[model samples]
Target: MDLQAQIEREGFPPGTSVIPLAEPGGQLFRATQDGGTRGLELLLTNEAVRMYGAGPSLALVLSRLRERAERGLPPALAPGVYERQVFVGD
Candidate 1:
């Protein structure tokens, strides 16, 4: 299934944003909250979707989104590939 479909199927929590990166072979997704710039790295796999948010900043992604929603703001981010990490097996 396509990345977007898979994500929709999984039913990511409200206020969560999933942006597919321009890479293949274990596709990476930039998950942001509250239309923020920095997003957590989401690794998609056949079995499950893994989030690589180990630190405090990364952990705040969902929280930030919730705050945005509470304030009646849309949780949308600019559409673009976040190239902070090098894509392997591309």
Candidate 2:
């Protein structure tokens, strides 16, 4: 499945925007509910997905993005992975 499809399966709210990256495993997305931006990268073997965000929550995420935007930095940054997901079969 594609990134959008994965997000849909995860049940994120609507109006989310995702941009594909040059790197095959990476993508950038913005949440519509609060304008929070996040980046994710899929690991090899599809065993894991990594995520990073500038802010902790929807509100703070948008705030940080706006600050970055105002300072001429890209809305998304070179962030360290803060989360890792591994799916387990039931």
- In terms of lDDT, which candidate is strongest? 1
TM-score of 1: 0.40
Write model 1 residue lDDT over 8-81, tens digit each, in one string: 55445676666665445454556665556534554443222233423332234334433443454433334543
- Per-candidate TM-score against the hidden true structure: 0.40, 0.26
Give a tens-digit lDDT track for model 2, residues 30-77.
Answer: 332124334332222111232233122222333433443334332334
Model 2: what TM-score? 0.26
Among all windows of 10 consecutive residues in model 1, the one with the lowest summed lDDT is: 81-90
Local distance difference test values of all predictions, in order: 0.45, 0.33
